[model samples]
Target: MKKHTFMLALTIVLSVVLGACSSNNSNNGAAIETNLTAKEMVDQMLSKVEQPSLMELDAATVEQLYHLNPELLEDYSIRMPMMNVKTNEIAVLKVKDVKDMTTVEDAIKARATDVQKQFETYLPDQYENAKNYKLIKKGNYFLFVIADPADQDKLVADFDTYFTEK
Candidate 1:
């Protein structure tokens, strides 16, 4: 009787453990790591809510915005950065190393400062959105979003789900 009980408990434990693991190879699967690209994750986020107008920055635009040496972050990929000037904005960036990570972090901060200045000068309406923006750094990726922060947790989780690579 004791052996039977032990066997049943072991079976249950094994089932539970197996159930927690991921079995899919696709990016959307419930895997241990994210299979989706940064752009894919951003698109997923956009699908979840009303997306704001964000202009994807080009080489010139990015260069003007950063206004620093070009070689430092040449390998950095800023995915589909879009901003509506006053309404809302979002930036998804992936870099090669920790040093570039700091540069990206600083860039976000500087952008926030720029937004603040805009608010002070001509667009007080952007204050509410800017005050509680979401900034997330997971692995080598950096995400900055300015929107209704009510869904911030969900947004972060959505991005985080794909952090681990297959």
Candidate 2:
């Protein structure tokens, strides 16, 4: 009877310890710290793809178009298709604080929804790209990409490498 009680207590202790360790690792965002600036990171990722006439966007233009203010970001890079008819865009942002993540994410989703609406009627392929875009977050950084579906996964995998390699 005493042996059974001892084993139960040990099992409970181990469970608590393991649970706490896993929680800490996840909450710490896996301690992702990259030496590259946001612009450099995005530029490198874009270089891997067969880009299609993308134009870099200034902060004011981003604010006007996406309703996401540059002031809230620690660093960022944005590129949109040169032609309004093309629905391809890439936005990579590092928020100054984790608390601002929801705000930034919400704005990006809204921008995606708006873009989908704009293209859904006139341009089928562009509309599909906008509808099936990838929006992902890692640590304090967020990446929102609307491009060829085949390229989206590669871009996300490349982004993960930045975190993992560090």
Candidate 3:
């Protein structure tokens, strides 16, 4: 009877240990699978857009390009003047990829001030609410930046700087 009881207690302890180990392994697997880099997310978003056309325009001309429709401008989170004129619509630039700097929290951390200044200089009018812009890091490879509708031109230009292939 003593040997049988010892065996039963050992079996219970072993089962508990096995269960805990399996749970930990599963959690680790999940973390690995969900670990996405920033660049990957940006690439994914860009891939979904119809081919983007590059165009340069002064700040004032942006409203005219989009037909001066405030409603249209308000419809999207980030509106670029590079539009599908046939449909009178702006292509949505989603967060498709994010690459975090090894040491920085923001994707454009080091370049943030420079980037902001560049936008302000090139597109002053749009920069009125530049502080409100949203920079979302979807993964390690993609950094999704949301531009205000009024800042479409500046945003488009900024976006081109990152998304355009070398």
Measured by lDDT, the strongest candidate is 2
Tell me the tens digit of each residue's lDDT in model 1 across 1-166: 9999999999999988776643322334432345666567777877786655555556676667655333554233343335445546665666555467677778777776666666665666567667777878665567777666766566777777666644
RMSD of 2: 6.0
Each candidate structure's TM-score, on Cα atoms with residue i matched to residue i, is: 0.65, 0.81, 0.31
Q: 1-166 in candidate 3: lDDT tens per residue?
A: 9999999999999999998865643223332223222233333444444424433333344334322322322122223335422111123222222221232223233333433554565556435434344443212222324344444344344434443211
Spell out the clash pairs found in candidate 1. Answer: 33-164, 34-162, 34-164, 54-82, 54-83
Per-candidate Cα lDDT values, in order, are: 0.63, 0.86, 0.36
Compose the digit string of candidate 2's lDDT tens values, residues 1-102.
999999999999999999886564422535677888888888999889776888888989989888988899999998888988888888889999877888
- Give the poorly placed runs of model 3, Cα more than 4 Å off: 1-40, 49-102, 125-130, 138-142, 149-166
lDDT of 2 at 61: 90
Off by over 4 Å in 1: 1-33, 68-85
User: What is the full ranking by lDDT, best candidate first?
Assistant: 2, 1, 3
Q: What is the clash count of model 1?
A: 5
